[model samples]
Every structure is written in structure tokens, then in C-alpha cells.
Target: MTSLNVTTTTLYMARTISLCFLVALMEGLDLQASGIAAQGMAAAFQLDKLHMGWVFSAGIFGLLPGAFLGGLLADRIGRKRVLMASVALFGLFSLVTAMAWDFNSLMIARCLTGVGLGAALPNLIALTSEVAGLRLRGTAVSLMYCGVPLGAALAASIGIAELAGGGWQVVFYVGGVVPLLIVPLLGLYLPESAQFRNARESAPTGVVRGLFREGAALPTLMIWVSYFFTLMVVYILINWLPSLLVGQGFSGRQASWVMLALQFGAAFGTLSLGWVMDRLPAWALSALIYVGILGSLIALGLASRWESMLAAGFVAGFFATGGQCVLYVLAPHFYRPTIRATGVGSAVAIGRLGAMSGPLVAGKMLALGTGTTGVMMASAPGIVIAALAMFYLSVRRNGAQID
Candidate 1:
């Protein structure tokens, strides 16, 4: 009987982990497909580069409100239900986006999609962490995050391949359809976070405030800083790398390939970071990752030739993506279970502001001819600030009790 019980428990955990990964995959596809379709979208809408950026930013605006509401809903209703509903909503909007007749329609659809995407992430992160044991939590979270790079790469490949035959609309169609297919699977497989349920039952008054008011404030702030910096770096890479390479004299096809290399490197980096996180100090690991990123960025900026640029792109992806993954992994740990969703949601939403700003600022840099060296140097400060914040948070973690 004991053997059977252990087997059942193990199987259940495996199922939980798998479902979490599936959620990440679906969300990644939903979130990143548009960026891959950006050039085609600009051409279709007769938008200049700056105007094209608005379509992307509009989506993030929707995400802000959606994330807040979703966090509340997760605590009030249930994480599993919210997760499934958000995925469905995102998928539906994606389909609408594919059919958009003009830029305004596309912006509206993207905003709606953003709302769903924003809501989905916190619940998913909270639920995944709840099921995972402390010993393996980082691994479980990172496994789910591996979907991010995969989804991004999938979008890029589909976009490039169908540009001639199907155009940008097909990219949105695939993004919409794929998540819709995953919705039923998620509903069937995903379980509510047990911790969320328990917290809802026993949480004290003003639970959300406790994230900052209680001793948790220090770690929470650290998470915010790390999340913001990591996201900024990531968006800069994802939104600008292909164009950056092309401007450096690489062919369009070669630049596209470089982008893919970054995504692939990110996937592996997430897995490797997850493996090392438990064994090493969190801040130390994060700092090391940033150091690697800083070096890669410098190399990328100074590389006189294509071979070096490609190599630097791969390394940049490894560090940038992995660094962000760690922030997500650490978020839940920074707060008590009662406010876990809120904590994660706030960090993600705030971090997204930085994400939204990255490409815009980079565009400004291009306009000013800031050059790769200046742009790359600018990113280094963000990393250093985030690392210092993480170090402080680690100190606080030592004194606090995490529920």
C-alpha cells in the first residue's frame, strides 16, 4: 500500500510539471508571435518603424489591467480556472487579430490578447511553484520557461516561411489556433495550486499589502529590481537583435538565423540555470549570468565580422533569457503564499514597463546613431543595479521566514 501511494504521488507530480510546461509553451506562442510578424505587419499597415512600435505597446497596456485583475481573481476564485480562461481569451483575441483590417483593429486585438497573456502568467507561475517541492522548484519553473524560447523560435520560423505565401495574418492565425488547441488540454490536466487554496481560506486582512509591509518588503523589492532589469535586457535582445545584425551588414536570412540562435541558446540556458540555482547562491548565480551577458554584449558591439557577431548572439541569449527565468523562479519565494500571486503579478506587470521601454529606447538610440557600443554600454548599468539588488535581497532572505 505504501509503495502504491508513493508511485501515485510521483506520477501526480510528473503530471503537474508537464501541464505547467504546456502552459508555458502555449503562452509563449500567444505572447511572442506578433513581434516575429512585426515587419510584415508594418508593411501591411503602412506604418513606419516608430508607429509599428505602438501596436506592440498597446498590447502591454492591456496587460497592465489584466494582470492586476487576474491576480485578484486567482486569489478570490481559483488559479486553475483563471489560467484556463485566460488562455482561451488570448487565443480568441489572437484569431481576431489575424483578421484585423487595419492598424487600429490590430492594436485593439493585440491589447485584448495582452490582457489574457498578463493574467495567465502569474497564476501559472504560482500554481507551478505550489506543486513543486522546494528542492526542485527552480527546475520545475525553468522547465516551464523553456517553452518561451521554443515559442519565439516557432513564431519566427512560421513568419519567415509564410511571408511569401501566406503573409503576416497566417502567423497570427497559427498563434491563435495553437493556444486554442491547448486550452482543453490545460483544463483537463492542470490542477489548482494547493497553496493558493489554503491561503485563501486562512489569509489575514489586507493580504496584498503584506507583501511590502511585512518583513517581505526587502526581498520583494529585490525581485522587482531584478525582474525589471532582466526584462529590459530581454526585450532589447528579442525586439532589436535581428535588425541590429542586419544593420551591421548581415543578410536578412543570416540575421534571422542569428535570432534563432539566441532563442535556442535561451532554452538551454534556462535548463542549465535551473540546475545550478539550487546548488549555488541565487544572487551569485544571477551576477555570473549578467557578467556573461555583459561580455557578450561588448563582443557583439565590437565584433568586426559576422562570425563573431553570431557567436556573441548565442551567448547573449543564454544569459539574458536565463537571467529572467531566475527572477520568475525567485518571485514566489520572496513572499508568503497568501500573496504569492499578487507578488508575482506586480513584479511581472512592473517589469513589463521596462520591457515596453526597451525597444522604444533602443529605437531612439538608433535614431541618434548611438552605435552598438553606446547601446550595449547603456544596458550594463541595468544589470549591475539588478545584481546589487539581488545581493541585498539574498541577505534579507537569510533573516526572513518564507511561508
Candidate 2:
């Protein structure tokens, strides 16, 4: 009887984890839908590179408040409730994005959708950890989180299929509609965070303040810098790689196929990096990953041939996306259980600032007539900064709570 009970509990935990993956997948699909559609959106709106950059930044900017407020709300309410709400928010706005008739409306809808997507993440991480026992917690969370890139890969596949002739609207329609449908399933089957419910809520405030407590300043700052730089690289790739490819003379369809390679490489990186981090010192391995990433970016600058383009993109995705994943995997190691969600959430929220800057900066560079080579060259420093920070993190790991 006890054995059967244990088996049933394990099965239930697995189901919870699977649901988290779906939610993460929803975020990936919705977030990248705009990027995939950027060229079409620009054409539809009759906008230039600079204007389109704002559109990109708008959604990412929305992510900041979305993550901050979302994490707080999730703590006050329940992770399941907040998760469902965020999913609904993004889904509804995504539909609104599809129907947008002008640039302003499109920007508004995407930003609002960003809110929902941003809010969903911390809860997903928190819930994933809440259900997982300590021994398997890191592995389980990383596995579920890989759904984000997989969703991005699937979004690229939509373009590859030329569904609706690769129309931008089709991307949002599918992105919005699918999550709406998933909401019912989550509401019905997903459970709230049991730990959150049982614990005495920490005054429902002072969330960020906790990170600045004694002995927690430098590591907190270092991790935040790492998250910022890494995400800057990650999201610049996410939002502009497709459009940049188009600028480099590839067709939209072809660009998306390459972007698909990038996202899939990211998925591979996330999984592989997690495995590697378990076996080696994370900071040292991360430095190596950034080295590979820089090389890939430089090579990507020179990728004029189709084969070279694909190969460079894959390597860039492998290292950049993979390195970002390494950051995510290493983030939670800096906090105790009580503030695990808080520390990770704050870092991710700060990273969204970097994500916001990426597209806009790329737009400015392109507006100044920077070619693919120059653009790729310009972005390499983001990873270099990230590598330096992570290396420092390894040497001066004093800012974390020493529980």
C-alpha cells in the first residue's frame, strides 16, 4: 500500500512538472511571435527600422513590471491562480495583437501580452521547485524551462511551413489561441504551490530589500549583471536574428528556418549546459561557453553563404542561448529556499531590461547602416561582459546567503 502511494505521488508530481513546461512553452511561442512577424509587421505598418525597434522594446519593457508585479501577486494569491491569470492575459492580448490594424495598437497589444508572459515565469519556476524535492529540483526545473526554446523552435516551424504564406497574423493567432485553450486544462488539473500556502507570508512586501541584506550585496549585483548581459545577447538574437537575416538578403522563410536552428540549438544548450554544470564548476564552464559564443558571433558576421549562415547561427545559438541557460541554472544557487523565488525573480526582472535594450540598440545600429558583420561584431561584447561577471562570481561568491 505504501509503495503504491509513493508511486502515485511521484506520478502526480510528474504531471505538475509537465504542466509547467506547457506554460513555459506558451511564453516562448507568444514572446517570439512578434519577432517572427517583425518584417511583416513593419511592412504592414509602413514603418522603418527605428520605429520597429520601439515596437520590440515596448513588449520587453512591459516585461519588467509584469515580472515584478507578477511575482508579488503570485506570492499573495497562489501560484496556480496567478499562472492561470497570466496565461489568460497573454492569450487574450495575443489575439488582440493579431487583429491590430495600426502600429500603435500592435505595440500596445504586444506590450500587454508581454505583461502576461513576464508574470508567468517566476510562478512557473517557483511552482516547479515547490513540487520537486531538493535532490532532483534543479534537473526538473531546467527540463521544464527548456520548453521556452522548444516553443520558439515550433514558432519557426510555422514560418518554415509557409502556413498562410508565413503571414505575421497567423503567428499571433496561433500563439494566442493555443494558450487560451490550455488555460482550461491548467485550471482543471494544476495544483497551487503547497509550500506557499503553508508558510507565513513574509509581510507581503520587502521582496527586493531582502536581497540587499548582509553579505548579499555583491553576489546579488554580480548575478544581476550576469543575467543582464546574458539576456541582452539572448534576446537580441531572439528579436532581431530573423530580421537581421532578411537584411543580409535571405528571404523571410529562409531566415525563419535559420532562426529555428538557433532556438533548437538553445534547447540543446539548455539541456547540455545543465548536465555540464552538474559535473563541473559552473563559472569556469560558463567562461568557456562565452568564448564559444563570441567566436560564433564573429563567424556569424562573416556568414554570407547559406551553409555558413546556418552553421554560424547554430553555433551562436548553442553558445549564447546555452550560456544564458547556464545563468538561469546557476541563479537559484545564490538564494535560500525562502527567497529563492525572490532572488531568481529579481534577476530575471533585471534581465528583461537588457532584453528591452537589445532590439532598440540593434535597430539604431542598422539605422546607421551597419551591416550584418558590423552588427554581429557589435553584439559580441555583451557576452564578454557576461563572461567576466560569471568568472568574478566564481571567485567572489560571498553575496549569497550562507545557509
Candidate 3:
């Protein structure tokens, strides 16, 4: 390519990543909003642990279909249009959450909000990957994704400020309004995926057959396993960690601070590990992530001091959320451009099942008096299973190039 063409390509990639990062930021805030607002929501509604779990799972349930449909539609219409619509859908529902009058209403609003959040993600990933091309895909995806953790940190700050004044609704209000404002920006500035446009001429394939055909069956199954288990652990931490810390006698303020630390770690991890993913061997990266997850979980279970808990939270966030990013980066590599979003959306939807289950299971376990240690231990086996599956996928990728 000529110098001018190269410059144009670089500019386009930067613009795409920046816009997508904004969307990811909003999605992160909404995802963490329920968790940060959990204490206040519970108090307001007189909800117990199990009911709170249901509330968390209800939002996650919406993600399942949102991801599926978002990807399917993005493949059919376009990533840009689907993404803008998803953002609007979530923003509207977030406002509803702030005004919720009853437990049932709260669940309905959150579920709808989740559908928007869920739909936005696959489009974000697909856009970033296609723009960056193969060489810089990991770094580009990571840069966009790190916004998620930073947005979560922003939510923690909001939670801390609101907790002092007893205005939990403020977080939802901010989450709602900002994304709506961003919608116009997306419509005006975001470019349609050139790759998607090019691939549109090819004959479409059946979604199910595309995912499982041409030696894709094994990778698809493995991707689902990895996504499911990894997300299960990540969601448990996202939703339940604050309550767990408070239950262990920390002040709510302290718990919020810990959550902030975790999100910062997540941002750092997402950026650093994404860069490392391109440079390091895949199996090594997989091993590093899982071992870090295990050690952090142990630390979280055992730590009692405020500082120790904070450090544990940071480590856990680093590996758990970072590992999830790794899975997202790997997913786009497994399918053709024509069906890429569909494949990614399907894996993400499966992961949402685990995400939905995590909080509910943790809530049940805690309600049964199993406590934090028991919950952490229960997650260990799943982490191991996820690690093995990821390792297998990495080895397979090394053996035969797909695409």
C-alpha cells in the first residue's frame, strides 16, 4: 500500500476502536450497575439473597437471546446498525431500572437492559477485529475491551458517592443517559465494517451448519466450554464479591473501594495480557491465566484484612476478566467473515448461561451457610476444566491454520 493509503487505514482503525471503546464503556457500567446497586436494591425491596440472585440472573437471561439475535442480525444487516440499536435499547431500559416501583418491575427493566448490553458486545468485537486485520487484532480488541473494566471502575466511584447520600438510582440514571447520548455519535461517526461489506457477496450459510461444519464442531464445542466456565467465575465475582466482603464485616465503603481496585486491575490486565497474547505462546498464556485465577480465589477466600482483601480482589479481577478477554479475542479466529458474528454471538450466548448461573449458585451456596470459602472451592473444578479446554483449542490452532 502507498503511504497515503496506509495513513488512511490507520485513521480508520483508530476511529473504529475509539467508538467501539465508548460502547464497551457503557456496557461495562450497566453490567456492574446491578452489582454495585445490589445492597441498595436489596434494602429498598426487602429482598433476600436468593431473590437478589434471581434479579442478577434475570438480566443475564436477557443477554442470552440478545447475543444470539445481535450476531445473527449483524451478519444479515450490518454491525453498525445493530450496534446502534442495541445501545438505544439498553439505555432506555436503564432509565426504567432507576424508576422501578416493585421487585417484578425491577427484574423486567434489568432484563431488558441486559438484552441491550448483550447485543452490543458481539458487534463491538466483530468491528474491532475486522478493522484491525489479523496482525493487530488482539491489541485492538483489548484496547476496546479495557474500557469495560474502566467503566466498571467508574460505576464503583458512582456507587461510593451515591452510598453516602443513599441515592442508588443515580448510577442507573448516569448509565442510561450517557449511552443515549452516544447513540447519535455512533450514527454520525462510525463506519460500517468494510470486511462485512466485502463478505456480503458470498452465499450465506446456515447458522447451525456454519458453526459446526468443516472441522468446526470440536472448536465450537471447546469454545463454548471455555466461555461458559470462564464467564461463570467472572460473573460470580462481579455480582457477589461486594456482598461477600460486607458479610465478612467490611464496611460498604471498603467493599466499594475493593471493587474499584478490582476493576483497575481488570483494565490493566486486559491491556497487558492482550499485548502478551500476540507475543507469547497460547498454551503459556492459558496456563498463566488459570493459575492466576486459582491463586487469587484462594487469597480472596482466606484474606481477612482490608488491605489483603483489596489485593486479592485486584488479582482476581486481573486474571478473571483478563482471561475472559483472551477468550473473546480467540473467538473471531474460528469462523469465516460471512458467519463470524454468528459464531461469536453463539459462543457469547453460551457463556451467558454460565454467567447467569454463577450468581444464582453462589447465592444458594451462601444461603446454605457454605460461605465464601466453599463458593471459591466449588469454582475451582470448573476453572480447571476451562483451562484444559482452552489448552486443547490453542494446540489445535497451532496445528492447523483456520481462515
- RMSD to native for every prediction? 2.0, 2.3, 1.1
Clashing residue pair totals per candidate (backbone < 3 A): 0, 0, 0
| lDDT of each residue in 223-328, candidate 1, tens digit only | 8787788788787777666667767788656666776777787888888887887678756785788898899889878887777777887898888888778778
- Model 2 lDDT tens row, 1-403: 9999889778877888899899888788877777888878888899898898898888898888888777777666667888899899999999999899998898899899989988888788877776775555667777888899889888888767653575778878888998999899998999876677665365336656767775667778988898887888778888888888888898877898888888888788877876676567756686679888888888877878877888888888788877776676666656654565677677788989989988888889999998777877787777788788887765553343222
- How accurate locally is residue 126 in candidate 2, as Cα lDDT from 0 to 100? 79
* Candidate 3 ranges with C-alpha deviation above 4 Å: 399-403
User: Scored by CA lDDT, what does every candidate get?
Assistant: 0.77, 0.79, 0.92
Model 1: weakest 10-residue lDDT segment is: 394-403
Alpha-carbon lDDT of model 1:
0.77
lDDT of 1 at 235: 77
Give the Å shift of residue 403 in candidate 1. 4.9
Error of 3 at 280 (Å): 2.0
Query: Would you list the rank order by lDDT, best first?
Result: 3, 2, 1
Measured by lDDT, the strongest candidate is 3
